[model samples]
Target: MIPAKADIEAAYARVKPYVHRTPVLTSSLINKHINAEVFFKCENFQKMGAFKMRGAVNAILQLSEEERKAGVVTHSSGNFAQAVALAARTLGVQAYIVMPSNAPGVKKEAVKGYGGIITESLPSLEDRERAAVEIKRETGATFLHPSNQMEVILGNATATLELLESHPDLDTVITPVGGGGLLAGTALAVHYFGNRCMTIAGEPFAADDAYRSFHAGQIETNTTAITIADGLRTQLGSVNFPIIKELVTDILRVEEAEIVDSMRYLWERLKIVIEPSSAVPFAALLRHKEQFRNKKIGILLSGGNVSLSQLPF
Candidate 1:
């Protein structure tokens, strides 16, 4: 098991100098509309255009010089691909990126531009992992799990640390649940801070594994996930599952239409362009406003990588 508080604190120290101190935005417009006092963690402004960079950089920096020389391997829907690619390039190591054929072209180009070697595979996380494993055997590369490793979790936790530090009075934190890295990390931070802040995980209505898993008491990863939030399509991983089971309190599901509209809300109201996956938390709030009304809620915006033309407006 990962160290609960101290290790997470050390993780902040280890990766702080390398990552951006991402800003938080509180909007009165959101508060009036949703009737909730809201704080937004703008991770869309993070390096490589998402929160994955925090994990990727911290994981890369933790490696020994020999390990760095040996290089790294992983798979992603998009953001983590760019994160690992950019981090690996910075460390003068190779990044073997396995992605689905259906991944956004913008992300594919960004990965290649960062000098990452790209491999196309089926969209399933298992298939992507299998491909990366095969490449690892062939190239002697260390497999860096996108959201399953302790280091990545610690890196993800920093966002919460920053948020709570800036907005000490936040009563709750809402974030999207993919492989559970962000949720796990955020929960750890909330717990360590000795704050009663509730950690709420959000998922697409179409792919509600995390929501189901929370109720089932154990994650059911065998089923295929179906959602337009391609970034959140992965099942919970070994490291994240236990942490989430222990830390997360609840899960919310949001519809596809709400996701798109939430993305638009960010673009119009916040003047920020965010992807569908990142919009799920806001969509959850919009869909179930009464649940969060009059409460001081913190929303973690997971990323900003959408193709403008893809918006179904």
Candidate 2:
């Protein structure tokens, strides 16, 4: 289930001190093209190179003293694993992270560098889940879902709260969706603030489960590999499906090439290094320029966890 307002609020408090209050940036050049005042909540500056830290810290900290002592486990392509490992380290708890065989070397090294126990699996949630289960059975560690858990969603909401609070005049908020925790949390936060901001979600055309599910009025899962946005490869979770369907005003699909181009643009023009996943939203802006014309838009740059030389563009 989507986290309640209280739960999200509690998570905000729980992770307040641990996560970075990433800055909001604006560009007149971008505004001229989109015909909107664009504010970016750059999560690239976030700890562990993404906003994942907020949720990881909140969920890990909320564990019972016994549970913390027992330790925690999770799976991720990159950012969430690093977030969990860093959070667990902060709390003096052990963490086991299952990552895919195709995960970037930088991310794998980061997970290990943070002192996480690493397990490799096929590049699918089913494989990751199976590995996580096996690890749990062997180690007796609590598992933290990358996106499905309430604590995760709640922790994700803190970014939205910060965005809205920082930009009271924002009329729309755009975020790239993967498993939908960020979008779900953004939706809940926008609703609670009673603000009229339209929440628009972006995803790569190659992997747009959240978009399909929103349009179909049901969760949809599929495996298609066609995007460079590795962080956005996952389909929506059952818990995140309904929240996104009800709350997001629009779901925009961006092409893979555009994702790469936008990543380059962010680095060259904005002087911000964003991952392909974070660049998807900017790609959406280029594809549907008219839709966002003449409005104040907020875009969440979800992460900056890419090696400088490994950029696909």
Candidate 3:
């Protein structure tokens, strides 16, 4: 079920002590470049260096004592793995992460540093799921989807809730789409709290299942995951897709080059390090410049987990 405003509120209260209240930053130069007043909710500075911490903490905290004893398992490429690992460590629970073998080395190291036991799999969704299931069976771990659980979705909404609280007058809010957790949560927050703010999603052209799904009125899978935004390669799940379809105003697709350019631009202009997935929204704004001209928009900078050796710029 889609979590209600009350659920989001409770999640925020539950996770408040654990996660950082990441800042809302404005860049005059970016505003001028886009011809709009832009506010960036910098989740790049969040705990575990990403917004996933909120969801991870919320999910872990909701577990029963018995369940906590068994611990939790989840499959993720990077950010969510580290988030879950850190949250579990903080809560005195074990975390088992099933990661693709091709995931960035830095991110894998971060997961280990956060006390996660890692199981590597081939870079395929099927392989990742199989590994997670095997781990769950062996360890009796509760399987938590990185972005599809109700608690996780509400947890993600807290970031948008915080954003709208700080900028109630925003006409629109934008976030990058992957498994739809953050975007769906942003939609719910805007629906419940904003003064008529609409939610738009920025998606990569290479991993454009979200854009296609938004238009097709059903979940769509990518034929190939070739995006530099490795975090965005996953398809939408059953739980978050309906919420996204109903509440999101639009999904804009940006090319790989645009994502890379936007990532570099944000780092150079705002002096903030944002990964390619986080840059997708800004790239969309640039692609549809005239549509949002002279409007107040809020962008969720989703995360800052990037490999220095693989800098797109």
TM-score of each: 0.97, 0.97, 0.99
* Candidate 1 whole-model C-alpha lDDT, 0 to 1: 0.87
Q: Pairs clashing in candidate 1?
A: none
Q: What is the C-alpha lDDT of each candidate?
A: 0.87, 0.87, 0.94
Best by TM-score: 3
| Stretches > 4 Å off in candidate 3 | none
Model 2: per-residue lDDT, tens digit, 4-67? 6787778888899898999998888888877888889999999888989988998998888998
Clashes of each: 0, 0, 0
lDDT of 1 by residue, 1-313 (tens): 7466888788889778878888898878888998889899999998888899888988998889888888899999899999999989987989999999889998999999999999999876668989999999999888988888889988999999999999888788999998888888888888887378889988997888888888898887636666788889877877888888887888999988888888888888889878889999988878888988788999999898877767756
List, residue by residue over 1-313, the lDDT tens digit for candidate 3: 5567798899999999999999999989889989999999999999988999999999999999999999999999999999999999999999999999999999999999999999999999999999999999999999989888888988999999999989899999999999999998899999999998899999988999999999999888998989999889898999999999899999999999999999999999899888889999999999998999999999999999998888977
Runs with alpha carbons beyond 4 Å of true place in candidate 2: none
Worst 10 residues of 3 by lDDT: 1-10
Better of 1 and 3 by lDDT: 3
Please report, as a residue range, the 10-residue window in candidate 1 with the lowest summed lDDT.
Answer: 219-228
